[model samples]
Target: MLEARDMTLTELADQVGITIANLSILKNGRAKAIRFTTLTKLCEVLSCQPGDLLTFDPD
Candidate 1:
Protein backbone atom coordinates (compact mmCIF):
# COMPACT_ATOMS: atom_id res chain seq x y z
CA MET A 1 0.00 0.00 0.00
CA LEU A 2 2.83 2.36 0.78
CA GLU A 3 4.37 1.64 -2.59
CA ALA A 4 1.00 2.00 -4.26
CA ARG A 5 0.51 5.33 -2.55
CA ASP A 6 4.05 6.43 -3.25
CA MET A 7 4.50 7.05 0.46
CA THR A 8 7.76 6.46 2.24
CA LEU A 9 7.99 5.01 5.73
CA THR A 10 9.31 8.29 7.08
CA GLU A 11 6.36 10.15 5.65
CA LEU A 12 3.90 7.58 6.98
CA ALA A 13 5.51 7.61 10.42
CA ASP A 14 5.36 11.39 10.56
CA GLN A 15 1.81 11.53 9.32
CA VAL A 16 0.65 8.74 11.60
CA GLY A 17 2.41 10.14 14.69
CA ILE A 18 4.56 7.06 15.18
CA THR A 19 8.29 6.51 15.26
CA ILE A 20 9.83 5.27 12.04
CA ALA A 21 11.38 2.29 13.79
CA ASN A 22 8.04 1.29 15.28
CA LEU A 23 6.34 1.63 11.93
CA SER A 24 9.10 -0.48 10.43
CA ILE A 25 8.36 -3.19 12.95
CA LEU A 26 4.73 -3.17 11.93
CA LYS A 27 5.65 -3.06 8.27
CA ASN A 28 7.92 -6.04 8.63
CA GLY A 29 5.21 -8.01 10.48
CA ARG A 30 7.19 -8.12 13.70
CA ALA A 31 4.73 -6.15 15.81
CA LYS A 32 3.09 -8.23 18.51
CA ALA A 33 0.22 -5.85 18.99
CA ILE A 34 -1.31 -2.60 17.85
CA ARG A 35 -3.37 -0.03 19.71
CA PHE A 36 -6.80 0.82 18.33
CA THR A 37 -5.85 4.49 18.18
CA THR A 38 -2.70 3.67 16.27
CA LEU A 39 -4.66 1.48 13.88
CA THR A 40 -7.14 4.28 13.32
CA LYS A 41 -4.32 6.69 12.62
CA LEU A 42 -2.72 4.33 10.15
CA CYS A 43 -6.02 3.71 8.40
CA GLU A 44 -6.60 7.43 8.18
CA VAL A 45 -3.16 8.14 6.78
CA LEU A 46 -3.22 5.27 4.38
CA SER A 47 -6.77 6.00 3.24
CA CYS A 48 -7.64 2.37 3.68
CA GLN A 49 -9.84 0.05 5.70
CA PRO A 50 -8.55 -2.12 8.53
CA GLY A 51 -9.04 -5.22 6.41
CA ASP A 52 -6.87 -3.68 3.76
CA LEU A 53 -4.02 -3.45 6.22
CA LEU A 54 -4.45 -6.88 7.71
CA THR A 55 -4.61 -10.41 6.43
CA PHE A 56 -5.67 -13.74 7.85
CA ASP A 57 -3.01 -16.42 7.60
CA PRO A 58 -3.45 -19.92 8.87
CA ASP A 59 -0.39 -20.87 10.85
Candidate 2:
Protein backbone atom coordinates (compact mmCIF):
# COMPACT_ATOMS: atom_id res chain seq x y z
CA MET A 1 0.00 0.00 0.00
CA LEU A 2 2.77 2.40 0.87
CA GLU A 3 4.59 1.60 -2.32
CA ALA A 4 1.40 1.75 -4.31
CA ARG A 5 0.89 5.33 -3.14
CA ASP A 6 4.31 6.39 -4.31
CA MET A 7 4.78 8.01 -0.92
CA THR A 8 7.80 7.78 1.25
CA LEU A 9 7.32 6.90 4.89
CA THR A 10 8.27 10.43 5.81
CA GLU A 11 5.75 11.88 3.41
CA LEU A 12 2.93 9.71 4.68
CA ALA A 13 3.86 10.46 8.25
CA ASP A 14 3.71 14.16 7.55
CA GLN A 15 0.38 13.85 5.78
CA VAL A 16 -1.01 11.71 8.55
CA GLY A 17 0.25 14.13 11.22
CA ILE A 18 2.49 11.57 12.89
CA THR A 19 6.17 11.14 13.44
CA ILE A 20 8.27 8.89 11.24
CA ALA A 21 9.25 6.77 14.22
CA ASN A 22 5.61 6.22 15.13
CA LEU A 23 4.74 5.30 11.55
CA SER A 24 7.65 2.89 11.60
CA ILE A 25 6.21 1.21 14.66
CA LEU A 26 2.86 0.79 12.93
CA LYS A 27 4.52 -0.44 9.73
CA ASN A 28 6.46 -3.02 11.67
CA GLY A 29 3.25 -4.17 13.38
CA ARG A 30 4.59 -3.50 16.84
CA ALA A 31 2.00 -0.94 17.76
CA LYS A 32 -0.11 -2.18 20.62
CA ALA A 33 -2.79 0.43 19.92
CA ILE A 34 -4.00 3.11 17.58
CA ARG A 35 -6.20 6.11 18.26
CA PHE A 36 -9.30 6.52 16.13
CA THR A 37 -8.27 10.06 15.34
CA THR A 38 -4.93 8.91 14.07
CA LEU A 39 -6.45 6.02 12.19
CA THR A 40 -8.88 8.39 10.51
CA LYS A 41 -6.01 10.62 9.48
CA LEU A 42 -4.07 7.70 8.08
CA CYS A 43 -6.98 6.42 6.07
CA GLU A 44 -7.68 9.87 4.72
CA VAL A 45 -4.09 10.53 3.76
CA LEU A 46 -3.61 7.10 2.25
CA SER A 47 -6.76 7.40 0.17
CA CYS A 48 -7.88 4.03 1.48
CA GLN A 49 -10.56 2.64 3.68
CA PRO A 50 -9.73 1.16 7.08
CA GLY A 51 -10.42 -2.30 5.69
CA ASP A 52 -7.85 -1.73 2.99
CA LEU A 53 -5.24 -0.87 5.58
CA LEU A 54 -6.14 -3.61 8.02
CA THR A 55 -6.93 -7.28 7.66
CA PHE A 56 -8.27 -10.04 9.85
CA ASP A 57 -6.36 -13.23 9.16
CA PRO A 58 -6.89 -15.74 11.91
CA ASP A 59 -3.95 -17.79 10.86
For candidate 1, what is the TM-score? 0.91
Each model's TM-score?
0.91, 0.87
Q: Model 2, range 1-59, lDDT digits (tens) per residue?
A: 89998989999998888999999998887787889998999998988888887766555
Off by over 4 Å in 1: none
Model 1 worst lDDT run, 10 consecutive residues: 50-59
Q: Give the alpha carbon lDDT tens digit for every residue of 1-59 in model 1.
A: 99999999999999999999999999988888899999999999999999998776666
lDDT, candidate 1, at 28: 88
Candidate 2 lDDT for residue 27: 87
Superposition error at 56 for model 1 (Å): 2.9
